[model samples]
Target: MNLGLTPSVACVKPKPEDSFAISFAPLSVEDVYAKADDPANGAVVVMSGMVRNQTEGKPVVALEYQAYEPMAMQVFYQIAAEIRQKWSIVTRVVIYHRIGRLQVGEISVLVAVGCPHRSEAFEACRYAIDTLKHNAPIWKKEHWADGSSSWVSIGACETQGC
Candidate 1:
């Protein structure tokens, strides 16, 4: 079922063994991992991107994320599909991205990959995140304590403390 969700987000649970568990809201880091947890899969990899307290020597109080929801969701699916194609042993994949304001230390994105072995799981997880950062239509704005904000590309940030 599609859940009739906003086109900006994709929350699809295709199947327990092979699925792209995607979401575009405040995400539970633990839940993202759980989606890939299975006895049949011997290895599971999890990655979480969080909002930090500082960026480029400036004190960042919070972050505001915006996305072209429909395109972002499509990118998530594409990443997961690519993983499945390259790693046939992969049992599951979950990619969750958050939007709107996020406080320091809050999770902004999560990628979990499950496979029959540790190496494949790790590789798939890494590829999923890297691809998302480069391909996803998501943008972030750093909110500094000095009452300033700047739009930054996800993978092109030059901040020292980001």
Candidate 2:
């Protein structure tokens, strides 16, 4: 947990009705944003991860995301707890990541956090997305316009569990 992430502790999958969530079916960022909105919480930060048209100057046609759902769901819950512990003002955290072929400009994932103030909301929101990218059980495969395909693991995992 040195990297400001939650320790990988065993926990039940976060419930559908819980503040922590992960959805595979394409869910709207606006919907997740609405769920995190609260008059009591002055700040609501939403992070949207989109499939870009290129990577490192290489033209990308699409990306396919696949994950071990059980493990990924566990990590997502752990991240939510970590955010709450680090920033007690955070009232809600919602994450939605898509698994399948995604075209350019399509949203690949979304993370939203509600907090009493802007600072905590921003910090916790960034932490959730960064940690998920670094530690989740998801894998991304890039499809190039030239018909080349490659599985790219996150840099943080490339030297470890990968």
Cα-based TM-score, every candidate? 0.81, 0.87
**Tens digit per residue, CA lDDT, model 1, 1-162:** 887755433554344354443344678867877888888789889998999999978999999888776666677777777788899888888888888889999899888998889999999999999988877777789999999999887732222122
lDDT of 1: 0.79
User: Which residue pairs in candidate 1 have backbone atoms (N, alpha carbon, C) closer than 3 angstroms, thus clashing?
Assistant: 8-69, 8-70
The per-residue C-alpha lDDT of model 1 at residue 38 equals 81
Give the poorly placed runs of model 2, Cα more than 4 Å off.
Answer: 1-9, 12-24, 155-159
For candidate 2, what is the total of clashing residue pairs?
0
Going through the candidates in order, what is the number of backbone clashes in each?
2, 0
Q: Which one wins on TM-score?
A: 2
Model 2 lDDT per residue over 7-96, tens place: 354785553433544456676978989888877789999999999999999999999988877767787888888887799778888888
TM-score of 2: 0.87
Candidate 1, run of 10 with poorest lDDT = 153-162
